[model samples]
Target: MSPIKNPTTFFAYIRRAPFGGRLTQGQIDGVNAILDAWEYFKLTDHRWLANILAQVFHETGGRILPVRETFASTDKAAIANLEKAWKAGKLSSVKTPYWREGWFGRGQIQITHKANYLKLGQRLGVDLVKNPAKTLDPVIGARIAIVGMAEGLFTGKKLGDFFSHNTDDPVGARAIVNGSNKAKLIATYHKAFLDAIEAARGAVDAADALPEAAIADDVKPAESSTVMSLLGGTVGTAGMSALLGVNNPWGFGIAALVLLLGAGAGYMFLSGRWSVNRIKGHA
Candidate 1:
């Protein structure tokens, strides 16, 4: 979770592939809010961040913001829509109409049920039970989405349960929000968001545990002396082939090239550019 220096780069990378090349201020704001929360919380896990973004996209239907369960414009409308669905038998798995009790799904995490509101509210140090709509705020919603998944407050299954250094189970990570419902779909979103986040890196992360070599873009050309040595070697090899009774010119030349330049590059001509490290690798 290193802080990305430029968010615009992130937007640029995922614009066409994941975000479809069209961006709205609301979409940008929603994503930025989540990124801000990630930085503010001092979180360092990219998988956790990516999985959180996936959940946001899934819960908000790519709005990247909080909304009611039915995506209705108003609480009244959301409740009414739920009731309509309930009566129509569309909600076969629902035991009761949770929205009627004023605890319909809200926020990027979309916590439903009254108990979750109270629990998540207490953890967030806010009275969400009293003011449930407050969860609609992007700041609050992002925090809830990030923290809840991190701490396993949603369904007692955490991000760690599915993601770690050795394992990345985006499909299983659906346990952090709901059950295994739509786990594969959410996994697809997770990979997309994760790829975007990685591509968005503007600087080397302090916590990144990778060894790197700084190769100059413009490799230096070989010197005249070096060119003469290679030319001399080729001419010497050709003459030696004849002297040593090597009848086939192609076989002798190929063998010479393989032995002289074989492992990495054998030998490079002066006309080509070269790097010290590349030469070392060849050696």
Candidate 2:
């Protein structure tokens, strides 16, 4: 069972801002997928889960599912429109114009750039390089968003930095994925998500209920036995990288670079690179 005890209350709380007071089936499914990934990983931190939920709320523009850049409906359309934007110089900040190369952002985390694709693909054990569209798969997309931030793959900033037992900074937690573009705004969503998460019943460590001898030596105490059972009894360590690198499109660092390049969208990468943080608030 999910750590979230009261999903009914959780959805009701989110409807206010991120969901804009409504939800489509796709949005609900997206949220469920993320929650499942949470359990699959045997995560028990409510605040961390809330922060992740808040980011997905913002990054997907509330659609909840993995999204294409410019909110395009399909891959061809996303690429076509990105090409147009690049040609018209609307995407001036793109130092490499990665979109033109079919590296346009996709997934809940909106990962862009071929380097990011290759690196994350290696970490997640998916062929995002040869078949980038795999990032759009619900399971894979959820994993990218969660693991990217949880492990600090996007900006080298992990969730614990901002939300441990002694601290809670949703505004700062924004760095876990991107920078501070909508830090305060996401913070609000964070509070709301926290409330809903708190309402949910907490999960007991399924490992505790098992006979000591039945437990596998390789099984970590942190994960519940149920998670292991769901996985048919195994978890790989590939996606748990401690490496911290910057690949976001919406961040100020890249935006400043774009500004130097004349109204650049490199902010596209940081703010969104980490949302598509590719070119947020623009084409």
Return the clash pairs for model 1, or none.
1-44, 261-266
lDDT of 1 at 218: 23
User: What's model 2's TM-score?
Assistant: 0.68
Estimate, for each residue in 1-283, the C-alpha lDDT of model 1 and write its tens digit: 5555534345544444456655555676788789989987899888888889888888898889898888999999999999999999999999978899889999987999999999989998999999999999999999999889999998899988888888889999998888988889988888878876876575432232111101111221121221223334444555433323422333433543454454234334343555455334553
The 10-residue segment of model 1 with minimum total lDDT is 209-218
Report the lDDT tens digits of candidate 2 across residue range 28-48: 678888998888777777888
Listing every candidate in turn, what is its Cα RMSD in Å to the true structure after a full C-alpha superposition? 17.5, 24.5
> How does each model score on lDDT?
0.72, 0.70
TM per candidate comes to: 0.70, 0.68
Q: Compute the lDDT for candidate 2.
A: 0.70
Report model 1's TM-score to 2 decimal places. 0.70
